[model samples]
Target: MVAFASLKCIIISSLLLPSEAFAPQSNLVNKKVSESSTSLAGVGKVVNRVKDSLLSKERSREDLKIGIAGFYDRSSQIWEEVWGEHMHHGYYVPEDRTDHVQAQIDLIDEVLKWAGVPEPTGDNKDELPKKCVDVGCGIGGSSRHIAKKYGCTANGITLSPYQAGRGNELAKEQGVDDLCSFQVADALEQPFEDNTFDLIWSLESGEHMPDKEKFVNELFRVATPGGRIIIVTWCHRDLEEGEEGLTKKEEKLLAKINRAYYLPRWCSVDDYVRILKENGAVDIKREDWSYIIAPFWKAVIKSSLNLKSLVGLLKSGFSTQRGAYAMFLMLRGFNKGLIKFGLITCTKPKE
Candidate 1:
């Protein structure tokens, strides 16, 4: 939990954007998002009931979707409420921020290595829009990194207005504000010309998208010929030979994950790769990285349970109880082999 005073200090000192820029209405969901406010309202209503069913202190998968969604919706509020305490809102934080930053660079290096793009030259270090977009650019952390490292401007698109404003502020603080810009827009209906970006980065955000095909196709459409797209996402492992698939208990757990974390479904990596290939993305390489994620969350749970964390949660009004439940689901999903981590790198033909 993060104290309100701390949050206020962080927001006030770090964010100096114009009111229009930070306002909720300024950011908009991606294109093709349903405009049915009533639908959202209704979902919000049932979200609670579903959550209660899922987190009843007993294992059950019936109504898992509702349970999962409820957990997520609750968790989202808590994350936002205590944004100052958890950098990047509980996304994995590398032990060192600089190391985390460099890892992203290495990820990009891997992508460019595969895409066959020539290394940059000294003469053209500062370039604009030479073709990179970070989908789900939460808080613009990665966008700022890319801008600083490559001297190229990258458009970051996200649905959360709060994240966009804060991300821009961080950009300014880091002196990369000029090169990186964040908009409250949906990645699905990205507002860019077709065949525009040389690289499309979708990092751990695919699970939130309901229409996986459309999501990948949008990436394909925006990417130039010979361009590359790198996607890292959370997935559910493939069904085993004689096991019941996605028991009600599991569905509820996943739904809790979705609701709390804003994911739609934890689809399989095979499904994701197939979607990319179906949409004309070629030479797809897919790998399951669940081995890394499960243990990662286990450590987070331990850290969160520390004495300082307990004290912080009690002092802050934010619901750390809900946060613990979410972590539990995440850990359990990972341990049971129901959850998976996946990465895919694909390229569009130059011709």
Candidate 2:
């Protein structure tokens, strides 16, 4: 039964995965491999069969940017048409019926509120940041939101040229182009002057970074002293005291996910806290929002089931299709407690 379950997980997993836009991303591939994560791992030959079936390939570090850029470039417009901007997970609570697109918007506001991004002045008079940077910025959704909300200039970066161009075009149409700018750039080596941005926001993009510490270091380097940085991302669960790395089962699950999503080795929120501290960041805080975002993948799965989603996906090409089917693994990982929707916030100490 364990082998059967493991086979099921890998088969579904080996199939491919998605954006937090998860829904309308545009659909889960086939349901044959749809067993839970608890049923995955320790099934060797079946893993090979599933991998072969999916034709999943491991990308090198050199190819990470290319792979990620390709995935988004092919999939972003399809998702924008189907899911409506905000290509990240939605915030949800039991019995709450907010529309999914709005829920995605709510996540940005919720994360900033939790981070005390503006430091809560109680009079809506908190010092608005003069300049902000959205690292791993996808399609300029959050950038435009921040720019429009605070009247601040917001700059965004992405590896996908399509995203950079489309995001800029969308901002122009939305009348926020003057306040929002986007470029194709690497997050590990950011392209801004030092002591620049006062607020750094990275939503969901940290999952794609190959170097966690370098990502943090870059954020710190670009930030003004006293700047606030918030990273809301996907992370593996923290290791318990006395444990080493993730258990073999967890590794298997995440490995399949890595192949699907072009992710590098994952770290925990605890690891992030350590990195922030090492970088001399102050006021560190972290939280796990697994429960609150539980509805996200389910919503995505539902959205991807329709005809329009399918037609759009078919045209988006192979990797996007693989990503579409692999989304169930995201749910299975969450259900099994191997994956976490993590939030971490810290401030560069004023010097």
Candidate 3:
């Protein structure tokens, strides 16, 4: 009980840092300009745009990258210790009680199943993709899984160098190093040639993208003609017809989530489909898996109650703890139907 109290304190305190850290500095000159400005209405509109798109304040690309890398650097190992190698949410079945870790692996299989990515049914496993990319791969769990299952080479990329290094170490330890490679790379500008990968997989990474269009374009650019692309991400509810945008209350809630997770902005699953279509993707598919993933955050909260998890969170630093606190907010958003667990899949048309 005492330990829990300390954890609560850390979470609350860390939560206060985001706005201060990201807000632009004030100065006399800026104040004078504000005083001299005639059109404050336009500035308010601009501020709202930035708030919804960036955060409470503007964040440079480098700042966002560094924050994301630093958060993972501190927390990735702890997450591995607690949540296993797959750092994304688990897919649970109705009254289907399974071990938490297995649910995570099931999530991988389920995603592939939903995407219609077939696995080898015969002895020849090479029927699957020969080369695949796992964008924002966490510790290369999905990468190694795909490589082993398909008898293919899998490349995993992440901004966190620690994730890359640890992923490689795990691949070596698991005897899949020859089939897997992990490197520190940005998803926005993937370091791959056009039409190179037979499969492009991005699970739960699209939220960190500042430019959703560019992010999808990059994914499409590296795909071989007729290759598969799967993206499972967190998105807000789609706006109703004739609605210009989300309500301020909804934006405020998401803005809190964005700050805690080092996320750039929130977009709906519909937005992802539109972006994919605009980027020349064909056979686009999308689903709202919110109900399937509904229990994820609650399950995470339950796991974090133990003494070991608390110790780990304390050691991992404030960023991780802040994210830990945000878990409740995540649950709130999901319950209120403001947040969604979105899945999108598309095929690169054959040229």
Q: Considering every candidate listed, which one attains the maximal lDDT?
A: 3
Candidate topping TM-score: 2
State TM-scores per candidate.
0.67, 0.83, 0.82
* RMSD after CA superposition, every candidate: 13.3, 8.1, 11.6
Question: What's the true lDDT of residue 314 in model 1?
Answer: 30
The better candidate by lDDT, 1 or 3, is 3
Tell me the whole-model lDDT of each prediction, alpha carbons only: 0.56, 0.73, 0.73
lDDT of 3 by residue, 124-240 (tens): 555478899999897888999889878889999998899899999999999999999999999999999999998998887888888999999999999999999999888899999
By TM-score, the better pick of 1 and 2 is 2
Query: Arrange candidates by TM-score, highest first: which order?
Result: 2, 3, 1
Residue-level lDDT of model 1, residues 55-136, one tens digit each, is 5443233343243334332333444343321223122334333333244345445544544444667765433236579887
Query: Which residue runs does candidate 2 get wrong by more than 4 Å?
Result: 1-50, 53-58, 119-126, 307-316
Better of 1 and 3 by TM-score: 3
What TM-score does candidate 3 reach? Answer: 0.82
How well is each residue in 1-351 modelled by candidate 2, as lDDT tens digits?
000011112223233332233243323422221222221122233334435544455668878889888777766765576566677777895526659878878888888889986633446645777799998777888999888778789999998899899889989999999999999999999989999999999988888888899999999999999999999888899999999899888887777777767778788999999999999989999999988877765665555444333333333345544454445566678789988889999999999
| Candidate 1 Cα RMSD after full superposition onto the native fold (Å) | 13.3
**172, model 1: CA deviation in Å?**
1.7
